[model samples]
Target: MSHHRSPPSPPPPEPPESPSSVYCTPSPQSKATTPSPTARFFLSRHQSFIKPSPLTKHILPRQQSSNTLPPEFPYEHDTAKTSVGLYLRKHRRTNPAIWCSAIICLIFSILFIFIVVAILIIFLVVKPKTPVLDTSHATLNVIYFDSPGYFNGDFTFIANFSNPNKKLNVRFEHAVMQLYFEDGLIATQSIQPFSQRRKETGVVVIRFVSSLVSMSSNHARELQKQVMSNKVFYSVRGTFKVRASLGAIHFSYWLHGQCELQMSSPPSGSLMARTCKTKR
Candidate 1:
């Protein structure tokens, strides 16, 4: 037999170690003794950690807090307007331009208040009133027509302008008078400018001559009928520019006067009844 002996049988397997074999606590009796390196390593890893509960939640802030902002404050939305007053008005700063702006604003405010006061005072003191106008007399000098549509007439009137204001003198300028038979305008004339003292009346004499003035057939026929019946209807309209004088303050306005007259016909016609209205 060959002398090659089989390999020595393997050593028997050792028993498994306990689960706590890698870690051990030092007894109080060995407190003063230093541990080995391996023991120190195991001791260092002997910490205990708690597991998180499934139902628990963390407390975290919805937003981070800072000294520059208040918590839960109601704030106005910021805008991007480009006005210079957004930066300069009512802000705490040492700008010299702010003083100049403030002074100008104050001056303007004072001027506005002074102007308002002056107007109120003037209104109270003046107590201005409008003047009055009246038609005192009318005369139909003559009337003759060549044809039904052709008209010829001569008319005269006296206009009385009265100043009813207790403290105002009135002047009348750019005066014009118009004569109408029914709805047809027959003639127009301009009068001279005049003036009147307070509470005084002034008269203006106006004469109108119509030659070959064309009228509608209805107006012509109506005129003939009225002349035959010895009753003529005429309209007189007058316009004037009136100025009221109150010491250093004077104001002007337009004045209008209208008169309706019934008169006897032909050469001796005179006003029988009248209605007048004046307005501004």
Candidate 2:
């Protein structure tokens, strides 16, 4: 009713083209394409799977070998620290005592050696001696007498010797008494002492006698005549030598003396009294 004319009579239906003609047909140009939202999401997910992230690229893989060292290296560091501390503590404890003992021993050794050397030098270099001529006074006395049968006069001699040393130690080796007649030597005799001591006097005694006889023959008569005509006098001379030692000192001394003799005749004898004088 609405004047709707039937839609223009339906156009004639198009026929299908031949296969050779379809190959020659030109395609239409497409509009600028925009990916759908769902398609775009799918494409982004795929790209993420193909490419790696920045953080993952920068990181390096862990080494598989056990030879690699750890970052801290705790074992070597602890050993070095422990050794240093022990050395310091030990040095602090013993150093002072060791040095002090060494110094004390050195000083004592030096002192001992010095004392020994000094004593040796003193004994080797010094020499010692004692006093000589210790005897101060001496005296001699001689007496002469004539006997009936003896041709020469009998004489007795005595000697007194004194030591002045306060602590005297004297030794007498030998002593001799020589008697002279006028200017000629007559006789000699040895004197012996009884005792010796310090600050004391020593006494010596000697006796001498002569034996001679005159015969009636010519030679013996001539000898008697010559002897009777000669003048006779008496004198005494003697030497005394002594050696003494005390401690480490040694002493030696020599003494000489001379004296005259007095001769007296007995009541029944013909010889007269006379005094003999010493020559020197």
Worst 10 residues of 1 by lDDT: 74-83
- What's the true lDDT of residue 235 in model 2? 62
Model 2: per-residue Cα lDDT over 20-72, one tens digit each: 75544434432236666888899999998886677765564454333444657
Q: What lDDT would each prediction earn against the true structure? A: 0.81, 0.51
lDDT of 1 at 173: 71
Which residue ranges in model 2 land beyond 4 Å of their true spot? 1-151, 192-195, 213-233, 266-280
- Give the lowest summed-lDDT range of ten residues in model 2: 128-137
Could you tell me which residue pairs clash in candidate 2?
A: none
| Candidate number achieving the greatest TM-score relative to the actual structure | 1
Write one digit per residue (lDDT tens) for candidate 1, span 219-253: 88899899999999999998889988778767788
